[model samples]
Target: MGTYFIVREIQKDQETGEVRDGEIHFTDSNPYAIAYAEESIANRVIDLLREGTSLNNIREMLQNRHIR
Candidate 1:
């Protein structure tokens, strides 16, 4: 099998009616990699956002970070 990367952009919070955050998911033939990669990338993005990084900037950074 091959590795797969899934990226999801959250548009808004359902209950609070606020804009939601983005998420990244990684999956492979090995299940262990998915768990670690998913949470790690998510938390990292959250930290970056909390540190005052704009969403657009984050998008740009991620786009630059990933070629495919």
Candidate 2:
């Protein structure tokens, strides 16, 4: 079995009432357990958000790296 990572974020702009959705997935047959992969991916996503990167950009980057 392979490990999977699902990263999703939803945000709304209060002023413009705009909604933003971001999602990414990474799967690997690595030895690490699924829980570990999930934690790592979650942390990386949070870091990207803290750096002020847009959700769309983050999803793009992740997709470029590895999707599903």
**Per-residue CA lDDT of candidate 1, range 1-68, in tens?**
34343344467878899996565444433443322224455456556666776667766766687412
RMSD value for candidate 2: 9.3
Please give the CA lDDT of all the candidate structures.
0.52, 0.55
Name every residue pair that clashes in candidate 1. Answer: none
Q: Using TM-score as the measure, which candidate wins?
A: 2
Candidate 1 regions with alpha-carbon error over 4 angstroms = 1-37, 66-68
Pull out the clashing pairs in model 2: none
For model 2, the superposed segments whose C-alpha errors exceed 4 Å read: 1-37, 66-68
TM-score of 2: 0.41
lDDT of 1: 0.52
TM per candidate comes to 0.40, 0.41
**Predicted model with the maximum lDDT:** 2
